[model samples]
Target: MDINNTLTIDGAIKEFAPQIEKTSPLGWSWITFLSVLVLFGFYGLYTQIAEGHIVTGMRDNVVWGIYIVNFIFFMGVSYAGALISGTLHLFRSEWRKPVIRMAEWITIISLLIGPLYILLCIGRLDKLHNIALFGRIQSPITWDVIAISTDIVGCIIFLYMALLRDFAHLRDYPELKVPKWKKKLYYYFALKYHDTPEQRKKLNRTVDIMAAMVIAIAIIVYSVLAWIFSVTLQPGWHSTIFGPYFVIAAVYSGTAVLIVSMYLFRKVYKLEHVITELHFKNMGIILLVLGAFFGYFTFSEYLTKWYGSQKNDELLISILFDKYYWEFVISNYIGVLLPLIIIGIPKFRTIKSITFTSLVVILALWLNRYLIVVPTLESPYLPIQDSRSAWVDYGGTWVEWSLTLGGIAGFLLLFTLASKLVPIVQLSALVKKDKSEENRKSE
Candidate 1:
């Protein structure tokens, strides 16, 4: 199938079919690399399970370590996916079609991976069910549990709805060169969608409804996560702004991830025609706006703490500025400002430059999550007066670092496998839009 053929539904199927039907040698090599990281992560998990929390850097004073940081970071990314995709769909943005599927995938994949970190954080995994069995209404933990559970279901439905037309198209495509089982899989999931006007109306309506619901759910769920910290009596946490603060940060990081994903898929799949420089520029603008808001929120948060001058707040701020000085600067200052500079300057807003800036934003946001989790724990309300440095300071051990890498590899691996199952770009939407334009030209 010549990819340069005029834009049509059949042409799109032929163009995207190779993505599903065959894996290149480089693709297999990438998969192997990710698999190795995942296996190593599993080994780390096994060691943690066998040896208990003693082997980890977590102590009584610093009970939450990188695991909690990862949990919050991944959840933030997931919520950002939900917010961006939903808003784009609601507004019926034309440029969003190519990237929306990637955003949806980010939402589902991050949701799957994010909560696993909570399990890693729990010392007693055997009694994990107690959160559900003996949960209280007033508990933020309980709220998070319910909110995340609801969010997973909502996002899955939203993604499935988004994919339905593509599934039906693949199922019906005579030229689709895939295994019988794969075809059957598509047929079953396609739900007898025949592209009729009625079916189209119903599908569009359902997708629109799910989009709105997931957006609302994502906000509520992340806010609940923030509340889990804010409602606490601890310094650097008991603030009124943490909810909005977390939400803004999540969207900022999520936008960066989405941009990175778009860049990778566009390059790998050779989708320059579909995902153009304009898409990157549009997304970069969004990232710039988010970066500015995130920076403002970070300043507002710390400025309040510094001005209020409570002893615990003072101590926590001092720890952040003194002990975690480099991290504080990178995450709050460099991470936020660099992306703004890259995107704000017209000369620097090329696709490659924006993508590089996004990568920096991602690392900075991860560091931001670390800063939020670790330094605050180090400066607890009741200080641990211990001679042992391990008791006083928290550092991620090899096991924690391995698991973190593994979680990241797992996210990438899932995205890789998902692309093999369906088109990363929404082929149906693109074809439909192309047809609409053609019709208008004919008229």
Candidate 2:
């Protein structure tokens, strides 16, 4: 069982076998913590179901609240994952192999969780089916439904294609110490793949096609989400730039998330050899570039509105500066600038610093979505007279807060469970790369 024999399935199994077999106490602890949060979130959901939207802070004047913000933020992150994974795979970037699995996982898990927030936003659970059954093609909500469904299906196919070879390797490896049920699962998913030349050719072609399709679908889907807001008559919402603006912000936050996941997996699994500083450096450069573009979009969006000085736009801007001043500054300015500064400067770009910058960007992006949703709703074109402050202003209650935290925990829990099931790094890719390098050296 020579693990150095890169030409064989044995190499990949030997290298990644430990990850499948081992779970640290720390892993269990983290899982337990996430489970607690998830339960708490369910409790909040139960309360909301029993007591109704009255348990939440959403009101007639400000209908959209934290739930919508979370919905947008998660969907943005999911789209980001799809875009990054598909683009990297299409371009055949060598460095992408290590982190690509995480990106795909982010896409699927976030896609699964994000739409639940929409259900939370809906006051009537019984009428949920009406959206699909009676949905108008002319409506933006219908567009969103169609786009999300298409994107998720494409992503799942792409991810499954990407995983097939690895699944085959795991199934064939006699030394793999996983349970019999797990082995059967792998064998079932592997689809009788034996890495024959014909099989390889077909798999590669399918993956390549799926990769290209997912990229196109991801952009269109996320753009459709932006159109949902931009098509509305609200003051801040009715902007032509929202489509590309939202896309840029989504990729920005998604890249930050990829970096954070890279850091965590590398630290926890002791994968420093596989996920190296060079990978961080390359990804950090990407983060920096996206941050710059995001900053430009932010500046352009506000500049156009401020320079135009329409009465409704002016009111929205005033609300942003006065009521949401800190959020605006932190999300638009500090969130966008600090990552650029940290990653752009050669001296400050340590792995820890980059990870911290990513954490900051994630929070800032969430806040960015919050500002986008709440303030615009608060400063409606027609004011509701005789409304109380709580009714007029949007604020998240304990229930919303609980569910938000639960969503984050659910993401972590899913990712953690996924790691136990499959090697976080793409084992088949590593094996192929190693074999190629060996052939080159021999020649």
List candidate 1 stretches off by more than 4 Å: 1-6, 385-387, 433-443
Candidate 1 per-residue C-alpha lDDT over 1-443 given as tens digits, one digit per residue, 9 for 90 to 100: 22332467777888788999999999999999999999999999999999998878999888899999999999999999999999999999987988999999999999999999999989888899998899998999999999999999999999999999889888878778899999999999999987667887998888889989998999899999999999998888988999999999999999999999999999999999888899999999999999999999999999999999999899988988898899889899999889888899999999999999999999999999898888888887775565377786898999999999999999999999999999998888776445642453366
lDDT of 1 at 318: 91
In the predicted model 2, the residue pairs found to clash are none
Query: Backbone collision count in every prediction?
Result: 0, 0
lDDT of 2 by residue, 225-285 (tens): 9999999988888889999999999999999999999999999988887888888999899
Q: Candidate 2 clash total? A: 0
- Cα deviation at 223, candidate 2, in Å, is 0.4
Candidate 1: C-alpha lDDT: 0.91
TM-score of 2: 0.96
Clashing pairs in 1: none
Q: Which candidate tops lDDT? A: 1
